[model samples]
Target chain A: MEAFLKYFDLLELSQEAGIEDVRKNYDYLKNLYSGDSIEIAALNTDFSPELRQEYLARLDDAHEKLTQLLENKKPAVAQNTVRMDDELCDWIANIACFSGAALKSIRERMVVDLKDMFTTTRIQLQYLEDIENEVFESFRAEVYLRSYLVEYTRFLSLDTPRVLADYLPRYRAWAASRTTPAGMPHL
Target chain B: MIWAIGGGKGGTGKSFITSSMGTYLAQKGRKTILLDADLGGANLHTFFGLTRPRYSLTDFFDKKVALQDISVQSGIANLDLITGSIGSLDSESINHGQKQKLFRHIRALDADHIIIDLGAGTHINTLDTFLLADRMIVVTAPEVTALENMYHFIKSAYFRKLKFIFKAYDLTTSIQETWKNRATYDIHNLKDLIIHLKQSSDRVRDIFDREMSGFVVHIVLNQVRTPRDILVGENLKSVCMNFLGLPVVYAGYARFDEAVLKNINSKEPFMLSNRLSPVATEIKALAENIIAGTHISVRKDVANGSLS
Candidate 1:
């Protein structure tokens, strides 16, 4: 974000000066930074003729626009500039001071992505919650039913014939735990 | 819209219902993908009678193959299967990176409804996948073990999702922190806590209301032994509403029929073996009601390429 703001400042400075001043300033800055090495490989890189020309044209257009804005070449002004209301002026000032167009664009994109991420995640969370709810409820029911089974064991023990193994501590533990038994034990 | 089928406990028939639903949708001419997301025990393929999946989720995760390549075209028209790599690589082993990768593939897939058969339990991976789906169908039996697991699953998932949403709006407060502390059972009951949150952040209440409104937690009870088992569904609905302040609509109860067992033994969905079987019929009816209730139009999504 800071890097984007720095580039934006340079762009704004270019727009404020005349095209000639912008061109000269660009060269001055470029030379002052000549201590930095230029990549010969970048200039020598192969690109299709049409692509190269189009890229160059874009660079030139960007430079030209910045110079014109910097020069403040006043003619018939476009409606892009207006006497904004106090509220609007304050809003725009806040936005300009606190934001860069490039950064704003990035933030907009990020907001959309975040919204999508959260939306999908929220649904997943609901599913998890449902599973938890169901599982806990099942455990509750198991607790309830297993106790009932214990009561039933005592009920049947008094009245009729019943297998003691069915009422064994291991069976009770297994019933209480509700954990699935392991696959058929290795031979 | 994607609907994840999961139960808190393993072996409560999450894959069974998911695969059967996939089969039913295929028979109805809707393109469907049954994602075997159970990285632990990816046996959904076995339920389909496929001895060996040509490409499993393991291949995709390992970068040995693309997701599309791993997607096996089922014999049933318009149905696709993404086999899970269970025994070889357990579902619990996948970290956040792997889980995100799996979800990305699931979101990009073309299907009318991507029914994710989530791995059992409420680990971060499973919960994350569950949260990513558009809707969720929690399946459980009448047994107590299944109900308890399901309850905890819902509570954790809801808390995690709410925390994410509140944090998104930059409205983190003490209430949010209190909610995360699962120790306090009464946090779900405290109106004062919500009022405190709302006072600190106005949007908190709105976010909570919106999530509570759009959220659909459908409960489906499988393997009912008696009519009394049916009350378990109602009991769950009441608990959700009373305790968590979330609306839970009962999806339906599937009877414990020998046919479900037969399908398992035969390596076929009961719906395929006998569509008219009591349990299969119940499942089909439940599926229909769910689709209708959710207002998911297979035709509309197909037309828009949202579902293909």
Candidate 2:
């Protein structure tokens, strides 16, 4: 993985790099570290907790070096750098690989969460649509019924012919109650 | 499974066959939903002596009731009828969207068998509804014109089904370029075209094979005038094989019986009035054949993880 990065000059760690460049460099480092870790873990199934802790610490140290490079524009402690220590380098490489594993897990979880959110929102929308349709149907039926009632009332309130007569006790009570009457009284 | 009875020409006995089968199924104690999917010219109610349908397909569409609630029990007992718009339905009234609504409602209807009596035509709406069924029964008389119309109807349906299957596999553009071209439609044998399509996609091959193997392109020859009319069913079966290379089932024939005409004129179901008539007897026999055929398919479906 590191060899793959070496082929791409754009991926190299730099002093004047932006956050995106730092992120990209960190990703490459993490990928190389995690790949080595997976290989070591596959071989040494009975690895000790101490060995694991040592490898994890080395990984954290590499990330810190990248972070420091981004923040202060200088690499971490050059005088203290154990350039001849092959074991330390291997441990650091394993840590970066482990970071890649962690990033992969984080991305998978984000995808699942996004899917769940979309499904939940879709169900909510369908529920709202069903309620809306029900409301609309009720409003339409109500309007029809109201119009029917108005027409029925008008039909009932129409005056009767003179022969059949609209006159009844209620009509006479209304006539007496009125201030004036224009028509001739019927016996 | 639902069967949507439809084709391009009117007065082709879609209503007659649908009602006869529904009645026969009811008598045999199989619960059937005789759905009226004909939105434009719904007359299934009149065939069953219903002057006014209290509840209709419109009620389901308008959301006044669930599809189940609107199903009126036919006096035949086990069969239920859901009429399409009896009075207010116009051709322009039922749009594409409403037809989809009607289809969805038809699917949700609970019954042992569902038979949809669709309106006549190769109208886009009619074609879509016909293809939506689990099985398609193309009803044609022994007349020259009816046979010609049925031929074109089957071709259109076959093309549409192929088009749909190709679209699903994301091979629509390729299929359209290959087949929709002037040279391809001119080919007499659809089987040859299917063979060509099989070379391109296995999914297309499976769809074609499935349609051919499961159902036998069941044909019902109505209004058979003479003994020679019986030969029409056999002739149609041969044409289907030679042209489409599909096994065709001559389910049975409904002869030109004066009784059927009388019942139709009187606005009564033939099965209700005269079950002993030749046409009624033929229909009952046809219904039995259909039930037997469907049961076999149902067993296969159960084996394939499909259950009621």
Give the number of the best model, judged by TM-score.
1
Where is model 2 more than 4 Å wrong at Cα?
A: A1-187, B90-97, B180-190, B200-216, B294-308
lDDT of 1 by residue, B1-308 (tens): 78887768887788888888888888898889888888887888888788898889888878757776788976778889999875888766777787777778788888898898987888877877888877778888877667768776776777677767767876566555766773554432433355455555546666676665666777888877765566556555534553355667677777777768877898875677786777777777778867765321111111122100
DockQ in order: 0.01, 0.00
Report, in order, each candidate's fnat: 0.00, 0.00
Among all windows of ten consecutive residues in candidate 1 chain B, which has the lowest summed lDDT?
Answer: B299-308
Q: Tell me the spans in candidate 1 whose CA falls farther than 4 Å from its real position.
A: A1-187, B176-201, B294-308
lDDT of each: 0.60, 0.59
